[model samples]
Target: MDLAWVRQHVRQAAAELGFGLVDQTKLVTAASELARNTLVHGGGGQVESTVLQNGLARGLRLTFTDEGPGIPDIERALSDGYTSGGGLGLGLGGARRLVHEFSLDSRPGAGTAVTVICWVAGPPRQRKEMR
Candidate 1:
């Protein structure tokens, strides 16, 4: 997966959801890290974005999935300094910290999927209703 494309897509979604610059940066940064993990560790994956709403709240949700040797130990993977690959081992944990909501599912012989959401506090922008 192209990390740049993932970042851009996340930034666009955040902006559309009325997330400020800080929130946009957070979302993009998290997306970049996850996308990289999806490629290097998960053996490549696809990302999907969605505009979310909860009453007056607005948010952007990003989901990354890959069909590869899934994480053997999810708890260790989410630890701050653990890695299956060569790196600082902060991708999953750091990405989780940057978003309002985060979830992960992995089947050792199947694949892995990570989902994250960043929200804009307060009311949403005045626009057509999201479907």
Candidate 2:
């Protein structure tokens, strides 16, 4: 949907998953920046969020995809103080720092996709226990 909606949704999801206030704020901030980048630079895209489990850790993963022109220099894009747009240029790098896992894919004329994950350590549980 929109940036605000995305931010709110992400914050709620993080909270529901038992994230602390600081972690929740980090997720919301990251989601907002990426959502804005999708709408403004990517000309609109989709953001998908899901809960994840791996042994004793629980995590939240967010994937953003866009059909607009892809990034030509992913390295530069991820570097601090770099922006094709006239914004503050902390969107990508800052968001990456807020998450446990970060990935980005882009091809000049094709599109761009970004995935980020944040994990919280917990007691180990079986997969069935999650159900």
Candidate 3:
């Protein structure tokens, strides 16, 4: 999948969900980094984004999946300043910090799948009655 296109799609989705500018930027940045990792490290993969609602709260969830050489040490991978691709090593960790929920699944030869969710705090907004 194209990195830029993925980022654009994620940003647009966040905006459509009424995410504030800062929240939108955070989600976009995280999506961009993860998407690039999926392409460069995982030899290309798939990204899925969806809207989530829990009680009064709403959120956006993104999932990245790839069938490449999977991570052998998930903990080490999540550590700051640790990278296999000579990057700043902030993609996974940073992305985790930017969202409310984060999950990663991988094995040495199986593959990798990362899911993230960003939810708006407080109760859900009240809808107005139609005239």
Q: Assess every candidate by TM-score.
A: 0.86, 0.88, 0.87
Ranking by TM-score: 2, 3, 1
Please give the distance, in angstroms, between residue 22's alpha carbon in candidate 2 and its true position after superposition. 0.5
Per-residue C-alpha lDDT of model 2 across residues 11-130, encoded as one tens digit per residue: 878877778789889888888888888888899999999999988788999999999999888988888877667654566998899888999999999989999999877743333445
Candidate 3 local lDDT, 61-115, one digit each (tens): 9999999999889998888877777553566888889888999999988889999
lDDT of 1 by residue, 26-122 (tens): 8888888888888888889899888888888888888999998998999988988766666435668888998989999998979999999877877
Instruction: Output the better candidate (2/3) by lDDT.
Output: 2
Score each candidate by Cα lDDT: 0.83, 0.85, 0.84
Model 1: weakest 10-residue lDDT segment is: 82-91
Please give the lDDT score at residue 118 for candidate 1.
79
Instruction: List RMSD in Å for every model shown.
Output: 4.9, 5.2, 4.1
Query: Which runs of model 1 end up more than 4 angstroms from their true locations?
Result: 85-89, 123-131
TM-score of 2: 0.88
Q: Could you say which candidate leads in TM-score?
A: 2
Alpha-carbon shift of residue 2 in model 1 (angstroms): 1.6
